[model samples]
Target: MAISASVSLVMTLAFLLASCGGMGTHRGTPLELTIAHINDHHSHLEALPDQIVRIGGVDTQVELGGFTRLASAFRSYEGRDNVLRLHAGDASTGTLYYTLFKGRADADMMNTICFDAMAVGNHEFDDGDAQLKSFIEQLHTGPCKTPVLSANVHPQRGTPLAPQNAEDYIQPYAIKNIRGIPVGIIGITIKRKTQDSSSPLPSTSFEDETSAAQRTIDQLKARGIRHIVLLTHQGYQADKAMATKLSDVDVIIGGDSHTLLGNFSKQRHLPKSAGPYPTRVANRDGKPVCVGQAWEFSKAMGEMNVSFNAEGDVTSCTGQASLIIGDRFKRKDAAGKWVAVDPATPQKIAAEAATDASLKMLAEDAIASNVLRSYSSQTEKMQKESIGEASQALCLVRTPGESFNASGEVAGCEEANQRAHGSDVTQLVAQSFLRTSLRADLALHNAGGVRIPVPAGAITLGQAFALMPFNNVLIELPVTGEQIIAVLEDAVSSYLDAGRSSGGGHPYAAGLRWHLDMSQPKGRRFSRLETKDRQSGTWASLDPARTYIVATHEFLARGQGGYASFKPIYDSGNYVNTHFLYTQAFVDYVRAHGKVQRPAPADYSHQAVTTQAGVVLH
Candidate 1:
């Protein structure tokens, strides 16, 4: 919460007051609107765990982000004119709070906070359409039903969503009064991501993103709604691109990609910047459009001031992406230098040192605190209950392949040789998926899903949830040998060209084996590609004509996370949803095999064919 530059405490109030006839008619002077936004809350209802941040280039741990701080930050603008509170979605999944309560806790919190409207994020459909509808229906059960919007999603006729849409629970756009002005807020979720990567029902379909947005804008403008805000679940870059294309959108409050949009140069405690706050881009008519998005996990809240002229064009806009961090630990001296304390220092000063952290948790907003305590107490209890026990520490890491990242991760052959070929945890999870697969030839897993590393101790439900947090379903897609090889190459493409693919689609598998040469061309990197025979469990060379049932999660099976080769099956509706959660498979695997020990290190079946590169690194 270090402010490199001083921002007005009464910024929202100032904008509101100035909007209410500071001089003359609205036509003569610009009409002002204040938008307070949050996105990617991810069910982090209570205060987040203490995290380390670079403060003035020094690592410092501070307790940051919670529902209370967000509420407190917005409380200042209560009852103010020309002000709207909007959320850009992703208010689901992350912690034990979501695991125990589904989205009820999040609904309750957002119900109380009472956003004017919210976009439908991709993760909202993680539990399927019915659960998402149920979660939305649970919101406070009062007049304060937040407008849930997604213009591109068109639920088929006779579907639950279609009927509800006719009932007004889901709509393309909403018009709210900002002071006396009617401002149209259109919400759009990323169509492709939600369609392919999430668990939306089969009947739920998506239209082109750019088309949906423009159509909605035309519809709104036809109704004489000029001041428009697009609350979008699209990433920051997409928003910028939309700004350049759209003719009517005055402001965009965006989410997804969990991007931080602001100047963090002076604010050491805040996240690094992706771009400037209110990233300005010209619309189709070459007029400026303002785009603003807060960072993820409720760590920050965005305040954007937009002034519109009589023609409904933006005159001026300012966005403050403020990190809602609590006051904790100590600060540097007046000269801005961190002073190290000596062992012989006086008792009083030493007691007040950063090491002591004398000032524990900072004060939180009363209303937010009350709500958080109610649900947090139950979640905490659920988090502590033991789920299983590990025989030994199973080291969990995202990347286990070292040679694939030689430039960054490997200093020499020794370093590359020392790294594990594959993560025991991911491979274990893949094996679990295979065990649960009805009759798949093999099972595959992406490294990104393996979140928290397991320590040697009793594994709790919370720990397991943390490990595989996403509510991804198990799916087995039918693919030909060539398609499988294409995706395998796609998975390793990032490794082949690290500059283009930092997180190359690394795959961990069970009932399958392959040797890869990183130095070869992207498509030719893999060799000895094999899958286990379902009946005899014998590794056999992939047959080009054979139709293999490849077990994978919904995300990857839909060709997300760099596995575009599987997308053909998904697009053609040739995959089967095993109706099992990904984590449950791992849980079953652990329970079946009691007291799992630290796995023996295994060598990579694949490595860079150094000679193929025609060069040598010292």
Candidate 2:
């Protein structure tokens, strides 16, 4: 193992502390722990192939991530003492695997690692509590019996989650005895975001995150557990702030927001990381709290090692996240087609890649590979059946003019967001909803609902499923023009003003157009509001008093993701659910319409945009 200078310093301190026999009792029985963790795998059990990564300052295509490689990494520490394996959260949704098997496949793959404990992410309830229950049951069926936890969730007595007993399904925390010392791992899920954006039963409720975490910490303290680790599904920024608000939380392994926390300066293929790995924050008691999160989609794993004093205060913390990869390499030919490199290049690339601390080259684990093979055989056939074709790739952008997806991954559509319009893929989804609902005059959709960009060529059944993987249904509501403007403002403020820049609340709509100015306050960002005439194909100014039927997914219509105006209209008995699956509606739209193409400029929802800095995007 190549030990960096910092690692050497940490090791020296560990040795001296060990020699001092508990550091003279100010530290108590000093404990040193190793944690291997991953988060937001999101059902991506198979490795992503043909990904371009920079090795030795050269662009080389290779396979990256997957449960197989993650399993291999975890198994490497099998005989090591005081080592803990954990998965932060978000083990389901976002791919064909979840679409077809509904988290069963995810559970099988997750059991490969046999995590000590897994936090309950919001997407676990996408199919409702019953489905979550089934997935949890499968997770426990294996030998691991990993605890599924959420401290803030409160299930109703008769609900599927708590029908018999809440403890039977979910736990508030797990106690892991490492080397004769009991360590408390408390789980905290995002309270508001889960209740708003997911499909939890209305009868079930959630407690505030801070209060729940504090209360749980008190309970765990009463049990005499000194070392505390908060395994949270809260965003990275939120977790850092949470540390300052609480005491005795020595470490946090978090998910949600899919944050990449590491020094990726040498990894050119990856985006700019959020921060340094094992980000250190000060807790309420002024003690150091180590916080870390792995990037999403099974791409990377975070390994953190922490040493505590006898008093359970974090004395030292060190570690880094490694991007998992294989040795196979590819490069684009002169004709712009991807072709495998010469056989000799693989070893050379691997030798050079080994120098970078963040890159790990490991072959897939045999047991995990076999488990994934059983489920992938069915998805392969489903992926092959073509549902539609696209003449040009559709760009996936959440906020207009933001830098995400601007990489070469989208091909010719790299500059798509440089224009005023936001997401081409989400706009197409909204259009599909509008076309399917004859009674609706407009369709609205959240940018986060659409997963990936569409490549030009034959679109398969699996591609459609992957693009719209949530278990959402189409709904229609008669909302006034004023309500439409209010919702748009709400969506914009949710991300811009409220700091959810991770892109869940930004709105994209069909049959509606507006000029957006972020410099304006709430309810004033949208101007020049217009609605298209279904009959004449002409745009007309919207009237605040006129009621228009709008089509959208059930998630948004339920007032989730900043669409608060729609909830009242839905509760007033003025809404109708088409019950048609949103993904199926997209497939039907493709069949009815010949081929997919980028929407015409006039049909775009964002006619213009002005940034908070007063810069305009035309």
lDDT scores in order:
0.72, 0.87
What are the per-model numbers of colliding residue pairs? 3, 3
Writing each residue's lDDT as its tens digit, candidate 2 over 577-611 gives 89999999899888777699889998989999887
Clashing pairs in 2: 27-310, 27-311, 28-310
Highest-lDDT candidate? 2
Worst 10 residues of 1 by lDDT: 405-414
- Poorly placed runs, candidate 2 (over 4 Å): 1-27, 333-337, 403-408, 413-418
Residue-level lDDT for 603 in candidate 1: 21
- How close is each model in CA RMSD to the real structure? 10.2, 7.4
